[model samples]
Target chain A: MSKYLITIGLETHVQLKTNTKMFCGCSLKFGEEPNTNVCPVCLGYPGALPVMNREAVKLTVMSGLMLGCEISRLSTFDRKNYFYPDMSKDYQISQQARPLCLGGGVTIQTPAGPKRVRINHIHLEEDAAKINHYARFSGVDFNRCGTPLMEIVSEPDLSSPDEALAYVQALKQILVYAGVSDCNLEEGNLRCDVNISVRPEGQEQLGTRAEIKNMNTFKGIYAALEYEIARQLATVARGGVIVQETRRWEPDLGETQSMRSKENAHDYRYFPEPDLVPVALASEQIAAWKALLPELPSARRERMVAEYGIPEYDAGVLADAKENADFFEAAVRLCSPGLGKTVSNWFMTEVMRQLSVTGKTISECPLTPAALAELVELVDKRVINGPTAKELSAELFENGGMPGVLVAKRGLGQVSDSGALEGFVEQAIAANAKSVEDYRAGKKAAAGFLVGQVMKLSKGKADPQRVGILVAEKLARLA
Target chain B: MSHTLDVAYVAELARLELSPDEKRTFQLQLETIVNYVEKIGELDLAGIEPTLHGQALVNVFREDVVVPSLDRECVLANAPERNGFEFKLPKIVEDA
Candidate 1:
C-alpha cells in the first residue's frame, strides 16, 4: 500500500415505498408510461400546494430508529433552489439544517473486528424527474418527481473501500429488516455518492477531496473509489495538488471523470418550504415508533446462533433475508426439540438447492414451513429412511403436501418391524445363495450385497439397517 | 450607502438578462427591501427562536392514499414541445 491514508464518506439516497408521492397523491410506480403519473403538485403547476405524506415521515423515522439514530423532535422542510430540468419547480424540497434523524452509526465487521461507521444525519427529500437523453432532444418524465427519498449521510470514517462496502451492506440490511425501503440498486431505489480524500500517512489536515456521484452498484462504487484514490495518490506524488471537484463514474471506461469544479457548483439557497408545515413529533409518538422497530439483522443472527444452536455461517445465511429466517424459525418451532441443526441442514442443502432451481424465495414456496417440519420429523422418528425421505422431499417441494399423509397415501413408510422384514431377508438369502456362501466362507462384505438384495426385493421399503440385522441372524443360524 | 449585493449575479441565478440601467434600478430597490428587513435585528430577541414559517401550525400531514392522476393528455397540454407522451426540451449534452 502507498504511504497515504484515504478517508471516505457516503451520501446514500433511498426511495421509500409509499403509496403516493412525497407531497402529492400521484402513485409512485416505475416502468409506467411516461408522464402518466403527473399531477398539479408533482408537475409544479402554479398555485398548487404540496401536502406532506405521513407515511413517508413514519418510514424515515423507522429507518432512523433501526440505525440507532436520535429522532428529532421538530423537523421542517426546505427548498433547495436550483435551475435543473430534473425538477420542474426550479427548487427541490429537502431538509437542510434540521433533519429527521441524527447521530446514528452502522457497525460493520472488519478484519480487526466490528467497527462502527458514524452517520452524520438522515434527511427526507423529494426525488427529481427522469431525464432521458436522446440524440436530438431530451425527454422529461415527471412520473418519478416528488417521490419520497431519504439521504443518509455518513461521516468520513471509512479507511478502505472494503470498509465502505461493509458499511453500506450493513446499512441496507438494517433498512431491509425494518421494511423501510427495497434497497434495490437496479431499480434506482437506492443510490450513493462517495466523498473521498487522501493525505500522507501522518498528516494532520485532510487533502482536497473529490466526490463521485450517482454510483448505483457495489462493484461500481468499489472500482470508482480504487481508481479515484490511485489518481489522487499519483497527483500528490507528482508534486501536483488534488482539486476539489465533482466527478462521474464511467463504468464502461472503468474510471471517474471530472464533472465540475467547486467554483462551478450551484449555491443552493435554502429556505423553509412555505407550503408544508413543520413536523413536531411528540415524545410519545417517537416512543411508539421505536417500539415498532423490528429486530435488526445482526441481533437476529446472534439470537439464531444462540437459540437454534446453529453455526455462525449458517446463522448468517438464514438471517440475510428476513423471510428465510422467519421460515427457519417457523419450521423449527413446529419440529421436535434439538432438531434446529437438522432443519438448517435441510435448508442449506436441499431447500436452498430447490429454491435456486425453481427461482423462488421461501415466501413463494408451496412447501410451507409446517410441511418441512413434518418431513424432518418423519426422518427423525424413523418413519421414513434417508433416501425415502429425500425422494419424498423432492415431491413435496414440487407439489406441497404433508409428508406423513403422502407417505401413508403412497404406502412409502419404512419396514422396520423384524417380523415384517424377516420374509424379505429370507428371500434375499435364498435368491443370493452365492453371496450367502461367500458370507459363510468369511466374506464379510457379502452381507452388504445381501442387504441390497433385500432392499430390492422389498421395493426399497425395508430399512437397510433393519435388513442388515435380520440377514446376520438368518446367516448365522444357517451356519 | 453603496449596495454590497451583486444584482447581476442574482439576475444570472434567476435566468434573467438585465441591462445596466435595469440592474441599477433593481439594486436600489433591493437595498430598500433589505434595509427594511434588517430593522428586525434591532429588537431584543436573543432568546427567541427563528420562525420556520409564517403559520403557527405543525405536524400537518396528509394520508398516504393515492388518488387518480391527471389525464396524460391534459398533463402534457401545457408543454411547449411534446415527444409523444413526454415533454421535450432542447438537446442537453452532459458535461464530460
Candidate 2:
C-alpha cells in the first residue's frame, strides 16, 4: 500500500456505573428477567414524566475528573427525535450542543511510545432496547432501555488500528481503575465506533472519513480498520474516489460494508427536553471535583519512575491500569520503598501471571497488598533464600497466607547468620569428603556437591550464593 | 420561511400505514415545529452556551462481566411465535 496517514477517531458508548438508570428508577443491571424492571417512564406510556437521576451525574463528573476534563457548569438534555421500536418515546433525550465533560485525554502506550488521545466530550443519554427482528414481525424488550450511557467522542488524533486498540485499552484501564465504569465490551457495557480517514502521505488536508461502527472488541476494531484501509487504497488505485459513509464491521467476513452514505440521512432533530431544568454547577463545585481528581495514569507513571526508581517500561505497565498502579503504590508503602524494583519485578511477573491465569484485576485479586509485602519481607530478612522464597511466595500468593506466620509455623528459617551457615557448611564438608577431595583434585564441579549437601542440612533455607562461597572457602582448607 | 419534512418517507421507513388525512394534519403540525426551531436559530447565540443535556456526562459502564441472561421462555413470552427461544417470522422472500 502506498504511504497514507490514517486518522481515526472513536465514539465509545459506555453504560454508566450507576445503580439506577437515567430518567427512570429501573435497576441498572445487565441480566434481569426480561422487561421486569421497566416502568412507565421507560416504557413511554403517556402521562409519565421522567425525573432525572442524580447519581448518574456524580459518576459522570467522577469520570471527567479522572480524565482531566472540564466539567460543564451548565448542561441540559435535548430530545433527539427518532422513531424505533426499541425506544418507546420515538425520540432519545441526549446531550447535543454542550456536554457534561470537555477537553480531557488519556495517554496510551503504543509501539511508538506514549500518545495522548484527546477526548472531545463525554455526554450522557439513555440507551435504546434491543429489537429482535423476524421475517414478518418484530419484538422489543425494554430491559436495555433507560440504561444510562455515556458517549465519549475522541478527537481525530489516532493514526492506526493498533493505536486505536491501545487507546481503548488505556481508556478501559482508567475507567475501571477509577471505578467509574466496568467497561465490558462483551456485555455491551462499552462499545466502540471508529471514524477513519486516510490521506496521501505528507498531505496537509484529510481525506473523506468513513465511520465504521459496532466493532465490539479491540481486535475487531483493528481488523476492521485494516480491511477498510486496504479497500480504500485499492479503490483509489483504480481511480475510484472514496465517498464518506457509515460502515459496519463484519467480523465473520473480515470486511467492512457501507451501511449508509454520509451525504444522506444524518440530520437528527435535536431539541431541549422540557421535562428537566438546565443543570448548573458553580465554580466552587467544579473546584471541589478538581480537588478530588486522582493521580492520573501519566502522572502516576512518571512519579513511579522518579520516586520508586522503577524502570520506565515497568512503570508504564503499572500505570496502564488504575488498580495496578494502586497496587504498586500500596506495596511500596507496606513494604520498603527500596523494594520498589523488586516489587515491580514480582508484580510484572508473578502477580501478572496470577491475574492472567485467574482472569482478575488487581482490585479483585484474591491476594492482598499486605500479604505480598510480607513475602518480599521474607526475602529481605533472609528468612528464606531467593529460590525457596519464590516457592513460598507462589504458595502464599496462590493460596493466601501471612508469610511471617507461615515461616514461623513451617520452621523454614534462613541461615543468613554466618555462624549458623558455617555450621551447615561444616556438616557439608564432613559429609562430602569425596567431593572435598574432588575439589582439591581440580574438579571444580565438586563444589556443587558441597552446596547441595549444605542445602539439605539447612532444609532449603541456606542462601545458594552464601552456600557456594562457604563451600569454596571450606574446601580450600582441605587442599 | 422554514423547511418542514415531508414525513411520508420517514413514515414509510418506520413501516407506518398512515392515511391521507393523518399525513395532511401532521404536515401542518410539523411545519409549526420547524418554524419554531427557525425562530430559535435566529436568536443571538454568540454568548449563550448550548446545553447538551440536563445531566453532566457520566462515564458509567458496567463491569465487563457477563451474567446469565433472561431465560428463553421469559424472553420469548412477548414474541408472537418462536423456534424455541428465537422469534420466528414469515418467509422474508417468496420463491421465484
Clashes of each: 0, 15
Q: What does candidate 2's lDDT look like per residue over B8-59, in tens digits?
A: 8666645588899998888888888888778987767898856544555532
Most TM-score-accurate candidate: 1
Give me the chain B TM-score of candidate 2.
Answer: 0.73
- Each model's TM-score? 0.94, 0.84
Candidate 1 residue lDDT tens string, A46-159: 899999999999999999999889999999899998877888889999999899999899999999998989999999999999999998999999999999999999999998
Off by over 4 Å in 2: A1-3, A109-114, A132-139, A201-205, A260-264, A416-423, A430-434, B1-96
Q: CA lDDT of each candidate?
A: 0.90, 0.78
The numbered model that scores best in lDDT is 1
Clashing pairs in 1: none
**Chain B only, TM-score of each candidate:** 0.86, 0.73
Candidate 1 chain A: worst-modelled 10 consecutive residues by lDDT: A260-269
- Model 2: per-residue Cα lDDT over A36-70, one tens digit each: 56666777767888777776776787888888799
DockQ of every candidate structure? 0.70, 0.14
TM-score of candidate 1 on Cα atoms, chains taken together: 0.94
Q: What is the lDDT of residue A101 in candidate 1?
A: 97
